[model samples]
Target: MSKRIQVTFTKEQWSMIEKFRGILGESDAELIRNIVLIWLSEKSIITTKIKKEMDDENGNRN
Candidate 1:
């Protein structure tokens, strides 16, 4: 199963995406999907690191 999301962008933001899409040869949806996936992956890594650091500070090393 999959989920759907709706996002809104300013005209300038969209124009930048359109220019980048032309260079990458991706549709708007495809570009947004890739961007979201990459962001989520990076966010997960950062969150994990922060949690580990907090655990270490609390002397909960594992």
Candidate 2:
């Protein structure tokens, strides 16, 4: 039901996460999750879902 991913941040990146988490009151994992989701949402797996529905309606193969 859930996945745990491990990441190794560079010194500068770890510092940034600490700074970000301090303000957000979240762990580094939560902070990274939000950041990545926001980025992915702009060009994400959702696109495949949308395309699938459209093709189903139009009977087109892709």
Clashing pairs in 2: none
Instruction: Give lDDT tens digits, candidate 1, residues 1-62.
Output: 57778899999998877876855458777788777766776778547787789799999999
Best by TM-score: 2
The regions of model 2 sitting more than 4 angstroms off are 22-25, 44-62
RMSD of each: 8.5, 7.6
- Return the clash pairs for model 1, or none: none
Name the weakest run of 10 consecutive residues (lDDT summed) in model 2.
Answer: 16-25
Instruction: Output the worst ten-in-a-row residue range by lDDT, candidate 1.
Output: 16-25
Candidate 2 has what TM-score? 0.55
Candidate 1 Cα outliers beyond 4 Å, as residue runs: 22-25, 42-62
